[model samples]
Target: MDAFSEELMRSVEEDDQEKASVGCGPEIHLPWLSQHIQNTVSHGHKGINFAQTTSICLNFIQEALLKHQWQQASEFLQCYFQALEDFNSQKRQVALQNIWKLGSAILYHHPKSSVETFSAFADRMKNIGVQNYLKISLQHALYLLHKGMVEEAYRNLNQAESWRYGEMSASQEKLIKLIQAYRGLLDYYTWSKKRTELSKFDMDGFATSAATQDMHSYFRQASVNLHEIIKIPGVWDPFVKSYVEMLEFYGDQDGARQVLTDYAYDNNFPSNPNAHVYLYKFLKKEKAPEDKLISVLKILHQIVPSHKIMLEFHMLLRKSKKEEHHKLGLEVLFAVLDFSGCIENITAWRYFAKYLKQIMMEKHLDWVQEGWSSRKDWWPTFHFSYYLAKKNWKENKILALEKAFTSGILLGKGCKYFMYVSKQGHKVQEKSIKTMKKFVMKHNILDSKEL
Candidate 1:
């Protein structure tokens, strides 16, 4: 078995042994975790106290996280709370904090769900006098800021500041400082009308600071001081992102490049795409030698190999008319399609797929077709959906349409193939449609007109 499954088994066994030592009726069984939960919910009949039950639930939640099963963990959390409804509010508060931690841990992996999950827990926990309510509020505000909900983030951040008015612990003080820095960063970005989209690979952002050279210098000093006071790392943290933005706003490309380069090479921190992308943009802006630019592009594609990176590589290769780079770009794109099941930029995926289709069809590259078709990691990306719908494969088209719906493909955002599937009066699962509608409305995408 895999390491994750082994760890899960170990935890489950420990929980079972603990229960057995307490003379609890039969040990909680799983793969049938729900059955164990049901028995626990029956309370005295199983000799399982609330503490033991909570231990099992928490272990299961950890296992789910290890497996990257955020949706499953989310659903199980609801079941856990519902089953333990008779428990006191204090216990629930503790459970909510556990849930919050899980939510925060997975934010980079599953941002939308993480944001939704944490927001729900924060709303409930804040009212119950949870000590870390401000910390939770800070995270929620960050997610809101990520989504470009500036007004909402401002309100949430202000509310957290109000929460800091009473007597505070050291950790609470630290959280307040972090929140204030974030508030300053947000205000600067909002005033300058800059967008911040935090992805798994690109968690940091550069804020567009105010106009006027003197004002810029003053604001930069204050931001730097706040960052130092909070002890926010100069790499991988939000403060550095804002600092980079300030530098960029002042046309200080060298300063921004230094920060990004240092972060990229920081062995103590994980490598992120944004660092490399920032460095690449710097090199490009400076009109650096083509060799240097290509080297950075290769590094980006090697690390990420995402649709965006691959597409960018392809464009550079085509622009430079380099056969080797073209070949490398195609290979990288094919490899990305071979393994990636959860591609984020469906539009970019579509673009590459369409480009490949044109090339393969014109050149009659049967080998290329065979290789791609054989790959097991077949996510029906937007292009795949387009291909299926265009071919008039009714069942496959519907399935692709439903997948797109779940991926939050806005009504007008999707390609013609998706619109064709949607107008067919085909019934997808109600939940998928509801999710799509909510995403559309949330992003105000319905106002977009289709030709």
Candidate 2:
């Protein structure tokens, strides 16, 4: 055994002793184990024996579970899954056996919550055998559907439908229903696309009749299947969206709104963010009352403050004349900036700077300074300064030029905005241009000739 394996084995032994003495199990320190596994797999360390490590980890997990240490067992399982992912890449046979063992363990302990996990394992075990083929097929079809491979998804589902499973469990029956739901979704997408194509061209009478019949057939399949499965919560979002879209496409605006409202406000269903997003978008499309739209967005924002559509919320607030609305709009922009990857988003920065400019013009200098100072370290300063310069050159010229020089220094010589500053410097008076050129050369921002 390598040092890591030996150390881990010693820890396991120490835990066994502690458990025997105290009549309670200790939680495994799994962070180190996870990190070790990742490092070993990533670096291809040959000294550590993974099979031995796997054996130790699995024994620890089983013991932890037997002692009613659910939390500890859960942690071990998470680490085990990480190891399994590594093994799947490096040792296929070991990974296959581990996948089976983990799946069996999950089925034995928590079958109810294991369906999704089992489906994921089954996807990995496709070349190997799965006892519950129907569940696997359903999951695979759903996977393909998400990837937009409609025909392949249909073929997978169709093959599963023809299978001769002797007796159906309740779970299997539910899988069949889900399969039908997906099939319906596929049909709806096909019909929608075909109708769009047919609308763009003029056809002869027979061709038009045939196309119409084909479109109707697809709609009938989608409608019947989706209607039957609409009440099945937890998996009804896609089906509901498709049904609402079909309703809207057919000019049944009332029906579409009703369906969206029901789904968005359903008490029994889990709180679904997309349900409200769907409602918000549909309401906006129908030009619903501003209050109604704001109400839905408020609920959604409370749930997920950093949702992408919060940009739309900000835009909506910007349209209002109320002072409170403008304040809320600025808050929305900051909220959007808090979202992941928005710090580097130029458009978000532009919105922030533009909104800040309005506040500056209103003589809210304190608020503008606070906002600008807070994000000065990382916000795209050049964009903001450029906007200010473009809008009012006399007042913001020095500020813009200074920001451009600093941005170029920090971002390196290849900074694109630096060139803009260099060009704009020549347009200034001789004294100001000379001062700016000296600052640029001192920083070595660009060559003198390029300037």
Q: Give per-residue CA lDDT, model 2, range 70-163, as digits (tens).
A: 5456556556643543434446445445545554455345523233433444454543423446666776676566656779789988877666
C-alpha RMSD by candidate, in order: 18.5, 16.0
Q: List per-prediction Cα lDDT, in the order shown.
A: 0.57, 0.63
Model 2: lowest-lDDT 10 consecutive positions: 442-451
On the 0 to 100 scale, the lDDT of residue 210 in model 1 is 38
Candidate whose lDDT is highest: 2
By TM-score, who's the top model here?
2
TM-score, per-candidate, Cα-based: 0.43, 0.52
In TM-score terms, candidate 1 sits at 0.43
